[model samples]
Target: MSVPKPIEFRGSALDDLRAFPLAARREAGHQIDRVQHGQEPDDWKPMATVGQGVKEIRIRDAAGAFRVIYVAKFADAVYVLHCFKKKTEKTSKADLDLAAKRYRDLVKELAQ
Candidate 1:
């Protein structure tokens, strides 16, 4: 079998990750690594059908719950579309919209 791709973070996603506390950020990093190696962590969850091909890595700790949204398309890369601390039981529309937009942009970019 082929090897899995490495994870690449978008600007906004990187910024969101940096905003998380140290422990949370470390946890998120570990989960991303798992994805990079083609191993889905237990906390991973698929997003809605509207955001097809996207999955969120759930990170819950004493601090709070955080999410990292990403899509693995090409054999060489996993694109991180969004990262944020979830404030409610469900993801906010704004966040989903942003991720969708970014996902589109990335697809377009790769097409060229």
Candidate 2:
């Protein structure tokens, strides 16, 4: 696939990937594949406003209920923002923070 014109990011999205091991990063590409194809889990939700025209997607991975946030419908590709292994119950506030941070960074980089 081709890279999108622009990608969105926030702290959470960055942290998710940052926290992952090298293997997880490789595996994340597969998950992104499913996301672009509308195969994300049923629990997924949008993270709302990010950049001037960017949108964030949050989803619960069916395999491990991990919380994943990323930018979708990004031109020709979906950029995986972040992925976090769940913590038993709902996702914690930290997750959101990271997502927000990623968003800011992306917006700044793109001057959005």
Candidate 3:
């Protein structure tokens, strides 16, 4: 079987991420860069699952842990979907549902 596709985050999400402060952006940048290099990068914490086609990249700050869902669209590009802070040990089913829904929406939009 062929390798699975990586979803990409374009448009607003890209703009938002690009607008993050240098430090925060750098953190994401470093992690994402590893992905570009064919690594499944993880930080100090384990990742939370948002859905089948969606996986959340976990990050932490003074506020605690949060997640960002990025879609691998190509060998070198990943499109981040949504970013939100986590309050529980496990990823909420609601978050996964939202990610799954958004993933479908993104796929449908990108196909055109």
Relative to the unseen true structure, what is the C-alpha lDDT of residue 38 in candidate 3, on a scale of 0 to 100?
55
Model 2 residue 33 CA deviation (Å) reads 1.0
Best by TM-score: 1
Pitting candidate 1 against candidate 3, the one with the higher lDDT is 1
Clashes of each: 0, 10, 7
> What is the Cα-based TM-score of model 3?
0.60
Task: Name the TM-score of candidate 1.
Answer: 0.89
- Candidate 2 on 57-111: residue-level lDDT in tens? 3433444545557766445445555568766675677765666676576546656
Candidate order by lDDT, decreasing, is 1, 3, 2
| Weakest ten-residue segment in model 3 by summed lDDT | 44-53
Best by lDDT: 1
N/CA/C clash count, model 2? 10
Q: Which stretches of model 3 miss by more than 4 angstroms? A: 1-25, 44-53, 73-76
Candidate 3 lDDT by residue in tens digits, 20-81: 55556667777766665556658633233543344556677664665667766434456566
